[model samples]
Target chain A: MLIAKVIGTTISTIKDPTLTGRKLLILRQADIDGVPFGKPYVAVDTLDAGVGDLVLTAHGSSGRQTEITKNRPVDAVIMAVIDHLEISNRVTYRKE
Target chain B: MLIAKVIGTTISTIKDPTLTGRKLLILRQADIDGVPFGKPYVAVDTLDAGVGDLVLTAHGSSGRQTEITKNRPVDAVIMAVIDHLEISNRVTYRKE
Candidate 1:
């Protein structure tokens, strides 16, 4: 799973039929501190997460494990919304 | 699919049971010209690709579509060895 920050959303008209009405969001990998970086990629959003929310994304086939994304051509899916992050027992990030 | 260059190999004894005896190679993403950049990642090599070879990798569940990687825990797989790359009617790279 990648710790990522939801940066924005995507609107696609002509896409795989399996992806119709799916919510695809733009994301960038984030560090444990919840700071975002790197090139952005799109992932199917199943959890009603909004922009600026730090979330956990499952990639590959695991993205299809969810009922909403099953058998879809999508490669990434937002599986969890991060409430906070801790490293070595020290809180590094907390949802605002 | 990503254009990547195999840089090295990995030797792991303790890993997911599904990955036992798999050939996991290290790779870095490459441009159409075959120049490598960014961080290195591991992928199951199903096509006997070797170091210095520019190959195409299928990521996510697509990596599991192959017979060698089916149901495995890996997220990436080398699916094709690139012989050459062309862009805009020009060959950008050719195997030596």
Candidate 2:
């Protein structure tokens, strides 16, 4: 999963049946250091992420692992809000 | 699919079996306007694309379309080079 920030939401009154009732958000992807990366892309929100929250994103078929996105038109999805991350015995981030 | 420019190559002494003999190139993705986007990422070359060539990329399962990448551990791969692009009522690019 990649780190991203929730920037906005898209209104989709009608969408793929599997996506019904799931929230979708426009997330700006970020690097491991929390630096923004690339153009904004839409991601199905699974972790109740809100604007300004840092989120973990999953892509490819794995993004559809959730029942709400399974076999759906979804590509990217938020899976978790990282409270902390450690790499090689280094503390990278801790939720403030 | 996204547009990208081949910049360099990575030499892998060994890789997934299906990737044998296929040339892989490191491609830098670009926006619709040919502007650079995000950090550099690698992509397998399929169309004999060389450095500085603006190419078309396919992601997800589709990126594994070729026999070289089929059933292999591959994600981003370049499928074609964009000689031109047209969107709306305007001509966007033409091979120089």
Candidate 3:
């Protein structure tokens, strides 16, 4: 699952207690017609998407399917926030 | 596992009653050619990657590498910081 667009954020008060209080953003990968690909990585958010919102990004193990990242030191998470996005049928986004 | 970028970020006063403090960033998909395709999306960061930093993100179960994210609710996570990236017969980005 990939359709991103939240372009900035990085904060760390010394990490690695299994990544205590996770929150780091920086993604730029969009496909399925919207365009804007390549270069830009960093994911660790569980919904509550903002900053140009067009969400619904879950990769690998389904980004853990959240129960607050299910098991532990999380990966990518944003379950769902996209209301409408069509490719061949058009209607790229419609979540007003 | 796509080649990703960092164009921006977002945050809130969270702390995780599960993930009350997970920071979110937007992302767009990129090909190995270093071309920007699609629109934009998001990812949860694992490293202190910068706006221009190319990272190695883990998908599915791979995102659950770290002890923090091991066997948890994570889906995608940055496994390596990408010291240098090469695609075909060339060097994409190297460690400075």
Best by TM-score: 1
DockQ for every model comes to 0.08, 0.05, 0.12
TM-score of chain B of 3: 0.67
Considering summed lDDT, which 10 consecutive residues are worst modelled in model 2 chain B?
Answer: B84-93
- What's the residue-level lDDT of A3 in candidate 1? 98
Pairs with steric clashes in candidate 1: A60-B60, A60-B61, A61-B61
Please give, for residues B1-96, the per-residue lDDT of candidate 2 as tens digits.
456667888888788776777788887766544555667888777667788877655568656655456667777676555555443334455556
**RMSD to native for every prediction?**
9.8, 10.0, 13.0
Which stretch of 10 consecutive residues in model 2 chain A shows the poorest summed lDDT? Answer: A10-19
lDDT of 2 by residue, A1-96 (tens): 778877655443323333457676656777656656776555778777777777888887777788666655445778898776677888776667
lDDT of 3 by residue, A1-96 (tens): 466666777798887676677766777765544454788776677666666555555665556556656555555665555555443345555555
TM-score of chain B of 1: 0.97
Instruction: Supply fnat for every model shown.
Output: 0.10, 0.05, 0.27
Order of models, best lDDT first: 1, 2, 3
How would the candidate models be sorted by TM-score, starting from the highest? Answer: 1, 2, 3
